[model samples]
Every structure is written in C-alpha cells, then in structure tokens.
Target chain A: MEGSDKFFVVVIVMSIIFTGLGTYLFLIDRKLSRIEKKLKEFRGSKNNDK
Target chain B: MIKSMWWKFLGLALVLYSIIAGLLIDVPALPVIHQTIRNLFYHVSMWFAMFVMLGTSLVYSIRYLSGFRMRDDLMASGAVYTGIFFGLMGLMTGMIWAKFTWGDFWTNDPQLNGAAVSMMAYLAYAVLRGSIDEVAMRARISAVYNIFAFMLLVIFLGVLPRLADSSLHPGKGGNTSTMEGLDMTMRMVFYPAALGWILIACWLLQLHTRRRALIQGIH
Candidate 1:
C-alpha cells in the first residue's frame, strides 16, 4: 500500500479498537451488576432458611 | 505525623516544579502545535504510576497465594484499583495528545493496540475478583489470574508492540530520547513534574489501602 494509505489504515484500526473496548467494558459492567444482585439475594435467602 | 508532613511538603515542591518546567520549556520548530508536548508530563507520569501499581499488585497476589491472608487480598485489590485509575488517565492524556498531533482522535497503531490490551487485562483482574464468593477462594483464584494478567501486560505494553513497527510516539524505534534534547532548564522542571505525579499516585494508593484496613478492622 501507499504510505498515506497505510497511515489511514492504522488510524482506522486504532479508532475501532478504542470504541470496541469502551463498549465491551460498558456491557460487562452492566452484566456483572446483575449477577451480583442475584448472588446477594440467593445468599440472603440461604441465611434466612438456617 | 512527621512523615506525613514531610511527604506533603515534598509533593508540593514537585507539583510547583512540574508546572514551572512545563511553562518554561522550549521546543524546536515542528509541524505539530507546541503546547501539545505538555501532555508528555501527564501521560508519562501516569504510565509510571500504572507500572508501579501493577508491580505492587503482583507482589500481593503472590503473598495471598502463599499466606491466604485477607490483608494481602486487600492490598492487591487496592493496587488494581489504583492501576486502573492511572491506566485510564494515561489513555485519556494519550488520546488527547494524539488528537492534536496526529489530527485524529484514535488510530490502530501498534503502540496504541498494546496499550489497549494492557488496559483490558487490568479490567479482567477486576472481573476475576468479582467471580468468587468466598474470600479465601477469591484470593486464591484472583492471585493466580493476576500473575497471568501481569505477564500479559508486560508482553503487550513492553515488548510486543515495540517489536512490531515504528510508532509516532517518541523514544520508540529510531527516535532519540527527547529527554536528551531538553536543555538543563527543561530537565530541572521535567524531573520535578515526574516526581510530583508519582507522589500523588502513591498517596492515593496508600490512603485507599489504609481505609480498607480500617473498615476490615472495624468489622
């Protein structure tokens, strides 16, 4: 590829990587909070039954 | 009390020095806007903090594995949190610098990819900690996983990217260390800026760790 074309290609790749990372973290944070809530509820129920 | 006061004074001095150096330093004529070089103070300092915190976390991880102590786990967690903070700051400052100098907000250069990988590995450390219920089990598993994550960070941030290709980043590939180009006046300021930023990061780590310990003790 030409020099300018190569630079642009690299730039596109970087932008995608950054945006994808931010999105992935946002999704994971949401999912983890849900799982934590369920786990807290389950543990509470177990303690009450004892 | 005396020690704390000493550190406070030292930190103050460092901050003043960094600010002065950043304002006074001269740059040769380049295509990029001049003031953007100021980001170097914040960007490099945060990376130093990240590396230091990650190293500390790795040490605590090993301690937790061998001793099964809750304190070790707490220390590891504190380091990871601090590491995350510095990593984010580094990423932000780097992105801002890139935007100004490169004329884009982001790009897929080898160095940038390596930095992204390092951040992701640190994120995984937090996820791993949350996965386990019991403290002992969590410590054991997180500690083991941390070793892997730390290695990945070393490889991704340190070795692999540098080996890949040329980067616009200074002090990489054939680029000379910009530090040497700086006159004595710049060095006088630059050293203090580095010192000040690292001191603040260390203070944050210590404060968080101490607070966690107090909470644990009270419970």
Candidate 2:
C-alpha cells in the first residue's frame, strides 16, 4: 500500500468495463472455424460427386 | 483460432493477468523511465509476438516450397499479415515510449531504423501479392519473397542493430541482456505477457488462414 499508485486503480477500473472484448474475439475465432469446417465438408462432398 | 480452444483461453487469461499485475506490481526506480517501465509488459511483448508470427510465416513459406500446397501458401500469407499487424503495433508503441524517454518520437537510433527497414520489407510482401493476377503464380512468387523478406528481417532487426556502438533502445548495440534488468516481480508478469501475446498472434494468424482457405475453396 505504501508504494502503490492511484493511477493504476483508475486504469484498472476503466479496463474492467471492456472485459468482454476478448470473449468476443474468442467467439469470432470459433465461429470462423465452424464456417471453415463446413466449407471443407461441402468441397469434399462435391468432389465425391464427380 | 486454430480449431483449438485451450490456448486461446490461456492467452486471454495470461494477458488479462498481466494487465492487472503489470499495473499493480512495483518496478525498480531507474533514471529516465520510472513508471513507464510498465511499458515493458506491452511494448516488448508486442515485438516478441511480431517475431513469433513472422517466424511462423517463414516456416510456412519453406513448407510451401517443399510441398507446393496452396494451403501452406495461404497459411504463410496469413502469418505474414498477422505479423505485420503486430509489427505495426510494436512500432507505434515504441514511438510512444521513445517520445517519453528519448525526447523524440523518431530518433536516429540504429535499432529504430532497422525496425523501420524490416517493416517496410514485410509490407512489400503484401503489395507484391496484390499486384499479381494469377493465383498459383502469386502464391509461389510471394512465398519465395516471404522467405527473402524474413531473412532481411533477421538481418535488419538482429544483426545491423547490434553492430552499432550505442543505441537508445535496450538489447541493442551488443547489449544483449535486456532481460537482466527485470526483477522477480517484473519477470513474473513479463514472461506471461510475452507468451500470451505470442499465442494471441497465433490466434490471429489462424483466423486469417481459415478465412483465406474458405475464400479460396469457394472459387
């Protein structure tokens, strides 16, 4: 407590409100993976038709 | 982003921890950079992440040369783009830090100039790809160029900077032990921050590769 700075608290508090941004990035990454998988399967099935 | 969930979560957790701990942790009071020492968690972490992603690009480019697979080329380009993004961030952050400590936004330091040269070389890779009309030719040529760019990257960033007699930046001018200044508390946060940013760079590269793969597959 003796050596602590108050600016840290303000920035921390501000950062708290933006906590979900990383979760959003994570979700988009997962969603993109799903899309990529589906596209791969579609291509595979089409290749089988020939 | 690489069809892996655990590493992404770990990246997020570690970065979040570093953000909090980086702020709260006590740093050694040295001249010129007092509280700004906390910037080590961010500015240095970014350059590390940039190196990791660009190194991945170099590896994938070599893989493409061996196999000539379109997918490997896509991955190489994706890693390059992500690496460039991180490198740009590193430059911006360095500029900000330099303004405070070195009393100028851009100095004549060899380290800083070398970083600029490397960034320009990578940027040319993107421009080279865009100008090519054919897919296979673009991939092959750009893959080759990517390797050359990475070699230049290693030279400009690693070799030229150290050959200088002195530098405003740490770890330059034969002063290789930049991490030696970190104490235990700083080390705890800095290591996690570096690793987290590297993983996050991987996540971004995977995202770019997947999107590119999907787009190429549709055509």
Worst 10 residues of 1 chain B by lDDT: B20-29
Cα lDDT of candidate 1 equals 0.71
TM-score of each: 0.74, 0.91
Clashes in candidate 2: how many? 0
What does candidate 1 score on TM? 0.74
True contacts kept of 2: 0.35
lDDT string for model 2 (B85-151, tens) is 9989999999999999989999998867877887888889899999999988998999989887778
lDDT, candidate 2, residue B28? 90
A11-46 in candidate 2: lDDT tens per residue?
577467536877778788878868877877987999
Going through the candidates in order, their DockQ values are: 0.02, 0.45
Relative to the true structure, candidate 2 has a C-alpha RMSD (angstroms) of 2.5
What fraction of the true Cα-Cα contacts (under 8 Å, chains A to B) does candidate 1 also have? 0.00
How far is B72's C-alpha from truth in model 2 (Å)? Answer: 0.8
- Candidate 1: which docking quality band? incorrect
Q: Give candidate 2 misplaced runs (Cα > 4 Å).
A: A1-8, A14-18, A40-50, B1-3
